[model samples]
Target: MDATTMADAILAALGGAGNVRGVTHCATRVRVDPAESARVDVTALARIPGVLAAQVVGDRVQIVVGPGRVEAVSGAVRRGAGSATAPAHRGRLSARTVGVLVDVFTPLLPAFVAGGLLTALHNVLAGPGVFGDTAVIDTLTWLRGPVALVGLVGAAVFALLPVLLGFSAAGRFGGSPYLGAAMGAALVAAPGLTADSALPAIHLTPETGWVIAGVDVLAIDYQGTVVPIIAICFVLARLERFFARRTSGSARLLLVPLLTLLTTGLLAFLVLGPALRFLGDAAAQGMEWLYTGAGVLGGALVGAVYSPLVVTGLHQGLIAIELGLLSTGGSFIFPIAAAANVAQAAASLAVWLCARRGTRLRALAATATAPAALGIAEPAMFGVTLRLRVPFLIAVGATAVSAALLAAWRVEAVTLGAAGLLGFASIAPGSVGPFLACLAVSMLLSFGGTLAWARWRRRRGRPIDGEDPRRSGDETAILSPVAGRRVAVESLADQAFAASALGPTAAVAPESGLITAPVAGTVSAVAATAHAYGITTDGGTEVLVHIGIDTVRLNGDGFRPLVRAGDRVAAGDPLARADLDAIVAAELDPVVLTIVTEAGARTFAPIDGETRVVAGTPVLGPVGSPENI
Candidate 1:
């Protein structure tokens, strides 16, 4: 597909460039940070030609196209967006915060991932088995050089994180990026300051160890720190802007950097550093305590909210908590995440099956559902479940259940990887069985539950579509096709058939799979799925025999036709053999609608709900009959 056109569609679907705050592309996705992420048309983007999947992740609308093409798409979007800026629309405060967070950290993620991968790879290759204990790796002298080299490469990226953060944060805050980077580098380059080193403390707490109440908060090194550096940059940006407005010319530039750095550096070192560290540590500790103390309840809670976190992009902040947990032992986050992600994926799969054949939604769902099996659930969640509303909630409930089960088994992940099927590799070897079981149960529950709920909803009888519900003063009758139990048209799930807009109708729940002619007529139309058939009666009445709701999506599977369109058939002649079990397996509603297309009719119901009924049953009495009412 042409990247330019695709980019145009992407931008359009994102509510135009005026709605966009930032536009960037990751390796495999085009990320459009929007002022109100909710306004971006995720389903529309998914339907756009060449788009793999589209979702709003946090405050950004992310479109997943493949790798090489994403760059082209990003460039096209930039050129297309031109000078437009995001409008000052008052959106949800939390979403706006998440958007800002996404903007700040998205650019720096490659470096973070590089650092993480290097650490994980070294642990696997030299220190121990990828998923097992390894102390012997420490004694392998030959491996030390290579492992150290890899570790250094990885650590080098993370070691200067503050500098990069300063640059990005400065630019975001409208200050000079270079100057901000210089100030950030200064925190590290300061003489006698070492990364993660303890500061000279006045006193230490016996319970929590270091307490700001007694000790200096800035005593620890700032190397590889996130929250503190962010705080420092926040202060530095305001200082830089303050100095810029008061000074003039080259002198302004000179003094702005000097005085801004001086004031902010002092503030950071003395105030922001200490305060942020304490807060960050407290938050991390709180997470640890909750996961340990509450166990299954904690897992269920986490599982329930984690997807929402992912949606808002707040999940990125969990990197610190996850790393902290991983370093100490195993992380409980991954297993829970697997349940949430896969359940969402399963929900999407259910939607896919329920969509009609060759529909754009079905095609989009195919692309959307594929990546979710590997832990990429944004497409499925945003494009499918979240769009539908009900499916996502079902997925959430299933996620909670699955995660609770994982917690019951005390499952934990030793390392981080894809959080769907591939995540099994990350689970501790001893917990693999439980993890797999959790995944299977969650998927089945999510998929089956969605289908059942959706079918039930459809059957609950929504308002009539198009035509009026009232019958004419005079009425006609329509015959029932193959049936076990005859039900009223109003009792049918499909509003169109239920309202008898075409005329009166009857719903039949088939006992045998056999579909038979309701009245002697020429076969007019037979759906490709073979689930629907139309016939014109000898009396010139147009009768439609539609079997199952959304079963047409099955595309003729499990349906065997005895006769085709244009064939003459008598009442009770075999029409088709449907696989009822397959229909249920596919999560389709099996109720059949037999409607009169032209002549007015009224329905008659069997006194018993499950009474035996069959083809040619006069579900609708003839026009003007007392039974017609």
Candidate 2:
């Protein structure tokens, strides 16, 4: 896409260009500063042709587009955002998005591992110079091209490291995403470290654990590995915030940059460098044990909790496992985790296909399916499957079963690219069949189980609570939009009520035929005829509910009441009965009118007339408007 189109597309993927205040990109991802951090649209970004996935790390919005496309995406973001200053609005990275990022991006981590391995391989093969002589020994050396290519391709993942984690971390902290990537790049520069360093080193003094070359190891390649760079960026973001708040003069702007660099640079030496090695080793070992011991069970457990982990913003901790495992040769956690992801997708897709939902719901399911299938389970877990109980179980069952199979068959993945069919290519040729079988079992079992459970619930005319009741709290309790009818006070239609305005509104029916209430409290005056009442729920804002609009001409002719003035009612409460046929005969629309009577209640918008609403349910809000009642 052209710069403008790309910028617009990326911004829209992050929720909207209007939400993005600033933008930057690196080799593989774009960083964004959205108006509201929670507003980032993970699915949309994942669906973008050039974009692989999206992550919110810290305060930045990171859009992964791969290495080559980073420059274009970043350029587009900068051009689109213009030169706007950071807004006061701040948001934290969502755990679900984080899961998506870790799953999607980490799968590719093997590429980095492969590159290092390949580079090592090249040194091993080229040492004898057999290719030049075509001797018997050189025959084996003929494979050098392929090996080098593999390693190069793998190394390329790290070449663009600044873009990947930079954007990912930025999204977490809610800062300038591109800036984070840029900062990461700076740590890997020539002057930053010696030639042989693997990552940046932290030192208390020159006498500390000796350097690789003249420069401190901390100033070296902080690429591919996790933790150190992330820590550095995190510290920098906080320091930036502190400076922004404390300094005010023109020199304040200069000081912000200066202090940020000094503080982060020092932190890199004192902490990030040393801490990463320890963290990476721990993550690596933990994943190794989980994979070896639990095998498929481990994967299933991880999959089941993966979505929740994303919500809690702790998924980042898992990255250490992948890094550590790759460095050590292999990790069971990484492979099984990939399998679990596929199981989740299978379960989600089964629900989407078997359940008869509306277009919107179907679309959401469809959108989440592909990514989940590809081993990116966040969208599926958060948007589609975890919304209910059965789907979650389906995902867990599939993952566990498949993971078990993989462990039993001793399937080994040699590369990475997510957990779906495409990712399967990474498995060693010897293990491919077993891995495939495991995946098949996972998908079939999970999908079939979810579908059967959903159907059974439908036949019984009862709702399946799904995986967890607490998580799916009162989803069925939304108010009905029916204008008239005296249904049971508490039917399956009414779900649990909460404590907020949007929570629950409980009231009894005044009349029998059809009950409606002046749901809000802002309303002060009813029509002159008293056919309806006014309500104000928006703290001080008010709204006027003139039942049937012009029906005010009826002058309470055909209405009856239940509870009178000073009574509190909730959604679905029976307020007053209205003769619908009479109103229709009077040429008035029977549809209940929810007029935006409050002037300041801009945040409250109608949720499409098609939605079923119940009486006393608070739909629109911000009471006490001067123009209302």
Deviation from native of the Cα of residue 345 in model 1, angstroms: 12
After best superposition, candidate 2 residue 485: deviation in angstroms? Answer: 18
The TM-score of predicted model 1 comes to: 0.41
Report the lDDT tens digits of candidate 2 across residue range 478-560: 23323333222234121211111221122222222464444323224333233544444424433334344345345455555
* Cα error, candidate 2, residue 238 (Å): 2.6
TM-score of each: 0.41, 0.43
lDDT (CA) per prediction: 0.66, 0.52
lDDT score for candidate 2 against the true structure: 0.52
Off by over 4 Å in 1: 1-89, 109-120, 131-144, 186-215, 218-227, 292-295, 304-402, 412-430, 439-629
lDDT of residue 369 for candidate 1: 63
Against the true structure, candidate 2 reaches a TM-score of: 0.43
* Candidate 1, lDDT over the whole model: 0.66
